[model samples]
Target chain A: MRGKYLLGILVILGALGYMVFGGLGRNLVYFLTPSEYLQDQARYQNRSVRLGGLVKPGTVQYDKDRLELRFVLTDGVAEVPVLHKGTPPGMFKEGQGVVVEGRFQEGVFQGTNLLVKHSEAYQAPKEGWTPEEVRKLIEEAQ
Target chain B: MLKTQTPSRPDALTWVFLGLGLLLLPLGLYLALAAPPDVNQGYLVRIMYLHVPTAWVGYLAFFVTFLYSLLYLFRQDPRHDRVALASAEIGLVFMGLALVTGMLWARPTWGVYWTWEPRLTTTAILFAVYLGYFLLRGAIEDPELRRKAAAAVGVLGFLNVPISYMSVKWWRSLHQTQSIDLTTGRIHMDPAMLQALLFNLLVFTLLYLGFTRFRAMVAALEEAKEEA
Candidate 1:
C-alpha cells in the first residue's frame, strides 16, 4: 500500500512539475510591448493581445462627453496608437506606464481594457503642498 | 511511532500568541489608517497593510507545512502529519485573503479586479495546488495511505509558492514589484508606511502561529475520536 501510494504521488508530482516549469516561456511574456508586437504584426492582427508601454506625453486626446480616449503607446523604439472607451482609471495619465488589452485593427489598437502599471516607489506628498502643486509634481516626475 | 504524541490541547504559548495578536490587531489597523498617504495612490495604499501580511503568512504557513511533511515522511509520525495538515489549511485561508484583497486593490488602481497576468495566474495555481492537497487527503480511506499521500502533496505543492512570489519580477506583469524587495533587502516605501506594514506583519505572524497550534490540537482530537 505504501509503495503504491508513493508511485501515485510521483506520477502526480511529475505531471504538475511539467505543467509549472515547462510552460515558463509562455507565462513569462504576460504582455507584449509595442516593439515586440510591431516586429510580427500579422501574427497578432486577428487575435486579442495585451500591449504594454508608456502613454506618450503629447499624444493624449480624451473626449469626456463620449468617454473616448485616444493616445499613442510607445516603447521608445516603436509606437502604437490606442483607442479605449470609458473613463480612464484614476492613476491613468500621460507619460504613465500602462497595459491595454485588445486587437490590432488597421494601424490602431482598439483597447477593451486599460490598466495602469505603477512602480514600487511609494512617496508621501510633501508637507503643506497644495493639491495643485501635488498634481504638478506628479506630472513633472513622469 | 518514536516521536512524542500530538498534544491534545492548546498550550500556554498558543494562548499567548493568540492573545497578543488579537490585542495588537486594532492597534495595527490604527497605524495603517494613520500612516501617511501615498503621493500617487493616496489612501488606496492602506490595502497593502492587509494584503502583504496575509500573503506573507500564506508563504510562511506553506513553508512550515513543507518542513513538517518532510519530517513525517522520514519519521513515520502522526504528529508531524497533523501539523502539516493544520498549516496547509491555514495557508489556504490566508492565501485566499491575499487574493481577495489584491483584487479589491486592483479594481480601482489597475481598472480591473483580476487579470491573467503572470503573478495572478501563478498565485491562482498555487491556491489550486493546495486545494488539491486537501482533496487528495480526503480521497484515501486508510489512515496511513492518506497521511503519506497528503505529506507528498504538502511537500511538492510548495514549489508554487516561490514561483508565484517571483512571477512579477521574472515577467513584465502589470502587478508592481515588491516595495520591500526581499532579494536585495532594500525598501522603496516611506518610513511611516513601512512602520505600519511591519506592525501589521508582526500581528499577523503571531495570529498565524496561534492558529496553527490550535488547529493542530483540534486535528489530534479528531484523530483520537476516529480511532475510538
Candidate 2:
C-alpha cells in the first residue's frame, strides 16, 4: 500500500515540476540596461522587456489631458525613447533612474508600465519643509 | 484515557523571547513611525518599517517550516511535523501581512495599487502554495500519508522563496531589490533609517521565535488530546 501511495506522489510531483520548470522560459522576462537592450535590438523587438536607465534630463514630457508620458532612457552610453500611456510614478522626474516595461517598436519603446527606482540615500527636502506644502507629496519627495 | 506524557509547555527560553519581543517591538514601531522622513520618500517610507520587517519575518517563518519538514521526512518524526505545521501557520500570517503592506505601499509610490510584476506575481503564487499546504493537510485524513504529502509541498513551496528574493535582480521587477544585502554585507540607507529597520528586524525575529514555540506547544497538546 505504501509503495502504491509513493508512486502516486512521485507522478504528481513529476507533473508539478514539469509545469514550473517548463514554463520558466516563457514566463521570465529578462531585465536589460539600455545599452544591453540596444546591443540585441533584434532579439527584444516586439517582445516584452524591461529597459532600465536614467531618465534623460529635459526629456520627460507629459500630457495630463491624455495621460500620455514620453521620456528618454539612457545608460550614459545609449538612450532609448520611451512612450508610455499612464501617469508617471510618484518618484519619476528628469534625471531620475527608472525602468520601463513594454515592447520596442518603430524607433520607440512603448511602455506599458513605469516605475521610478529611487536613490538609496535618504535625503530631506532641501528648502521648503511641509508635509502639506507639496502639491503631490509623493512626487515632491523625489 | 489517561495521559502518558506531559503535554508540552513553553519553557524559560520562550519567556525570554516573548519578553524581548514585547519590549523592543513597540520601541521599533515608535522609531519607525516617528522617525524623520527620508529625503526622497518622505512619510511614505514609514511603511517600510512595517512592510519590510514583516516580509523578512514571513520569509524566515516559511524557512523554518521548510527545515522542519525536511527533518520530519528524514526522521519520520511526528514531532518535526508538528513543528513544521506551527511554523507554516505563523508563516502564512506573515505572508499575508507582507502582501497587504506591499499593496498599501504600492499605491502612493508606484502610482497604482498593483501590477503584474515578477516579484508581486511570484509572491502571490507563494501565498497560494502555502495556503494550499494547509488545505492539503485538511484534505488528507491518514496521518502518515498526510505528513508525507504536506512535507513534499512544504519543501517545494520553499523554492519560491529564493525566486521571490531574486526576482528584482533576475527580472525587471517594479519592486526594488532588498535594501540590506546580507550576502555582501551592503546596506542601503541613511544611518537613522537603517537603525530603525535593523531594530524592527530583530524584534520580528524574536517574535517569530516566541510565537512558533507557543504554537508548537499548542500543537503537541492537540495531538495528545486526540490520542487520549
Local accuracy by lDDT, each model: 0.88, 0.80
- The TM-scores, one per candidate, come to 0.90, 0.81
| iRMSD value for model 2 | 5.2
Provide the TM-score, chain A, model 2: 0.72
Which docking category, incorrect, acceptable, medium or high, applies to candidate 2?
acceptable
Looking at the true structure's interface, with contacts defined as alpha carbon pairs within 8 Å between chains A and B, what fraction does model 2 recover?
Answer: 0.32
Docking class of 1: acceptable
Task: State in Å the error of residue B165, model 1.
Answer: 0.9
True contacts kept of each: 0.61, 0.32
- List candidate 2 segments past 4 Å from native: A1-24, A30-50, A102-106, A119-142, B1-16
Clashing pairs in 1: none
Q: B1-228, model 1: which lDDT tens digit per residue?
A: 343465767899999999999999999999998887788886788899999999999999999999999999999988899999999999999999999999999998898998878888788778878877876786688999999988998998899899899988888899999999999899999898899999999999999999999999999989977886
* Proportion of the native interface contacts kept in model 1: 0.61
